[model samples]
Target: MQDEKLNPSDETPKPEAGGAEPEFDYIDAEELDRLKAERDEFRDKFMRALADAENSRKRSERDRREAEQYGGSRLARDLLPVHDNLRRALEAISDEQRAQSAALIEGVELTLRELHNVFGKHGITLISPQPGDQFDPQIHQAMFEAPVPGTVAGTVLQCMADGFMLHDRLLRPAQVGVSSNVG
Candidate 1:
């Protein structure tokens, strides 16, 4: 190529030729501030949404655990009648009759014991109320009230139907007779 020379008047533009440096066209201060604000707002909203989703998940897990823990409550309540019947049958046999046929009585006793074992295995428990014990409305249903001379009022005079519990919850309240100080 031939040697070429440029005039000073046609020289390339210098960095500071103008009084001010060339402004960057890529982003203006107003646009940058608006974009940053938008980004910050979106970030805050996303974090909040994520936290809400986590809370919802935790709530669902708690509900599921509660359901699993108490799922058999209804079935356990229904099984209470079977336990009652078994107890009643054992109670029906007199001591004299039991002594007369020890083998037969033993067989009945064994069967009753097995039934109770099954109940315990499934978290079923008997609520045997004692005479003179304070009656509790939560676990005792008063069938009748009678005056029993020296007994305190609201004392359990008799348990007509035994109560039962499945876990800590009452499956059935005891049908009971209370004693009062009046005629």
Candidate 2:
């Protein structure tokens, strides 16, 4: 019997139903790409939400600090009238009466001193402009400008109303007359 020669293409390839072509479930490449993209998008959205929550927390903390700093603003404003009343009482009492009634004057003076001490403790400061002091627009409001021959121009001639400061911030500006050059 002659030996039968086998051609390379004459061999029948077995179907991949049994051997190791990695038994994988059929999945489309495009569909896989779409799924991966969706996962990435979800991850990005979660990160953004986390960042927003952190930012909101920081903002709330800042607001809380600001509230603490300015919490007594309304109360401070209301107490201003009490200060005004104290000043008025002192002014209303004449020097003759003060001399005649020493005990009454002393009591009034002591009360005024106590009030000022309380104001200082609460970070309230009086801004009383002395005559001939330089007029500062930031701290003083010019109610009127008048010519004064002796005093320098732009100097405070008189204070009509006392100003006040709460810490470093102006509570009220001093009302004053500014001196001008006399003709």
RMSD of each: 8.1, 9.7
How well is each residue in 103-175 modelled by candidate 2, as lDDT tens digits? Answer: 9878878887997897788787899999989999999999999898888889999998889887877888899
lDDT of 1 at 131: 93
Please give the lDDT score at residue 117 for candidate 2.
94
Q: After superposition, how far is residue 48 of candidate 1 from its true place, in Å?
A: 3.5
Query: On residues 33-73, what C-alpha lDDT tens digit does candidate 1 reach at each position?
Result: 99999999999999999999999999999999767756778
- Of the candidates shown, which would achieve the greatest lDDT relative to the real structure? 2
Q: Would you list the clashing residue pairs of candidate 2?
A: none
Q: Which 10-residue window of candidate 1 scores lowest in summed lDDT?
A: 12-21
* Every candidate's lDDT: 0.85, 0.85
